[model samples]
Target chain A: MRVVVPFAAETPKTRLESVLTPAERSAFARAMLADVLRAVVEAGHEPTVVSTAPLDLAGLELPGEVAASASVTADDRPLTEAVNARLPGGDAETTTDEPAPVAVVMADLALATPDALERLLTSTADVAVAPGRGSGTNALVVRHPEFRVDYHGTSYLDHRETAREIGATLETVDSFRLATDVDEPADLVEVIVHGRESNRAPACLREFGFALDERDGRVDIVRNEDCAAE
Target chain B: MRVVVPFAAETPKTRLESVLTPAERSAFARAMLADVLRAVVEAGHEPTVVSTAPLDLAGLELPGEVAASASVTADDRPLTEAVNARLPGGDAETTTDEPAPVAVVMADLALATPDALERLLTSTADVAVAPGRGSGTNALVVRHPEFRVDYHGTSYLDHRETAREIGATLETVDSFRLATDVDEPADLVEVIVHGRESNRAPACLREFGFALDERDGRVDIVRNEDCAAE
Candidate 1:
């Protein structure tokens, strides 16, 4: 299977601005992309990173196949547009040369593992989706040629309706790791709390001196006192 | 909101028999129950554990209200039938004194956090469901007077159609914490990998000398040789 990870490198994760600076956010975004790419390759699939800007993947340890191949495509278009154009039945897609199956995964799924990615990529459903915490499509596999994603409001629901309209079967992949995308400041807490042993997203953030303070029944992301402020 | 957690204490988690003895499975189930109960109480709600048999919660440290109140109800019946009998629209339920809103949560949600429970219980939607990994309803809140549960095959889909049939609003609490339920040996890896720092399910399993050997990209639950076999 071929997977396309849509990453917004420029001004990415704006919701995390309160906890992470612009530079930190960009670096964190790259780290998350690395995690997603590794998971895709480890799940036995080829991945191409569709970024809003040219990604500086320096110092980030990614899968060799992804880094060496022309896997990272820089497109400054919106997430939905860039992703749809790469789909099998989208604009300029030739019927004879179209890819039979393709998957679109968000770059911010910090908790995703190879097992979770395997479930999504190998699902026999016409449209397999891993929905976000809200009405967002975090990761999805498109076997049906007519099913294209829309990143607008309530996109998860829209994807279901669109699949139905196109007479495609929709299977919801209820995976915790794939469903939880790190988009907000509070989401950082989730990654720290539930991240796997070797998950690099949290390791990268921790290297940036990030910590979560859970006290008095409230959770907050804080900087480590030992590490001096930048 | 009043929340009911359906627990099968007699022969719990039969799918895990290959990995755990019956006694260990029951103890692990109770540990998971304790986690869910604490999450519900900390989320600021009342919970009652509806068990198939009287639970032996001797070693498990549960929430004060859950441990103190006459909250544990023993009903030896099928899970679907037992739960439907408690709903407001079920038989012998008073139309005048019906609890306007009620929530049903599975006791095996080892990853459920207080924040996840708060999202399900505090939803203004007429019906809120936290679907499990498959077509199972892991947790749900019911506000519609005519709505009832059916734990048959594809219960999650059944609940959605039931809500629509009764002219009630349905909202999916797309929560990862509430979705991952500890069931099989393979699921043990999930608990150990993604379990919170204070989550007791993995801790309880660890106490049983359970360990995951993730060698050569394959995850296997094993016993620590240092610890004597049970």
Candidate 2:
């Protein structure tokens, strides 16, 4: 099976701008992408980073054994179209009689682990999906050639319906790490709180001098005074 | 209209026991109940505390003019049955020619504001429901006598079905304060973060030595040494 990590390389993580500068957002996005790539590599899958803009993969610390590739989408299309183009029956040039299943993983899943990716990729169903909170399709393994993705309003529900229409056996994987995508300021709190053990994203957040603190009677991200002075 | 606050006073806030002792849970539960009651009173409504055990309203600091009552269920019935009994066509006996609408509000809405409650009570639908973050019905306004309450699994969906069965128009009120209910340890983070601006629940949590802190890469409630000594 082939894995594709869809990344919004250009103007990424707009929601996180409230807490992070543009440079910090770009660096954080790359750190999260690296974290996801490391997990995919650890799961014994060679992942291709499908980016919006040309990405410099030389700086990324991927697993030594795993051969990772980077490709830029021809156009600035919706995530669904960009990811769909890389699938078996998609527009990408390929010469295999039987196209292998393609798994599309979101780049923002900073908490995802190798075990979680292995579980998603190993599902026997024609189409396996990991649903995110608030009706989102976080990651999907599309084994069926005819199955396409639609990331518009409540895409998880839409994907389920599409799978049924194509007579594909749909399997839903409930994973906490895969379900979490860093989108809002509230989400940063989760990354800071849970990503401490992980080296990539949590380390990046700490290096950026961000810490969770209760300010004005609410939980918010506060800059460490010691780090700020440095 | 009369407002009814359903409280699980016996084992209130079992989820918070990880951070709070049994005594602290009881105190926190009472503080949240008081906050909800204060909102109901400010909304120009008299609220009754429908609890598992008989409650002492004299201890609660309610508004001066708002007269609050307390009632205990004969048995540990499901929340549906308990709240249903307080409705117009419900088990509660009525002598007037027309039965006034009754609003059922959950006791754990720590951030509930007066304006939010007023919006719910003033809704013109035969049955109005405030949907919680998960599958919970935080509050409901039943103006139609035929309308009933169902607090089963995913009760908000069940309530909508029940309203349709009764041919009553259902209005869904979306209020951040009304939508938030303290259920899990993670929920306490929201309370500590958002409730700081509010005096009632935030003050009570702070007074109990509870504060948000990151431990082992997760946001958790921790006690201050000075406050613990107190």
DockQ of candidates 1 onward, in order? 0.07, 0.02
- Model 2 Cα shift for residue A39 (angstroms): 0.1
Question: Please, what is the whole-model Cα lDDT of each candidate in the order they appear?
Answer: 0.77, 0.76
Task: Estimate how well candidate 2 is docked, as a DockQ score.
Answer: 0.02
Q: Once superposed on the true structure, which residue ranges of model 1 sit more than 4 Å away at CA?
A: A56-59, A63-66, A92-95, A225-229, B1-177, B180-230
lDDT of 1 at B203: 91
lDDT of candidate 1 over B67-93, digit per residue (tens): 663277788888888878777676535
TM-score against truth, every candidate:
0.54, 0.52
Count of backbone clashes for each model? 0, 6
Please report the TM-score between candidate 1 and the true structure: 0.54
Error of 2 at A110 (Å): 0.1
lDDT of residue A188 for candidate 1? 82
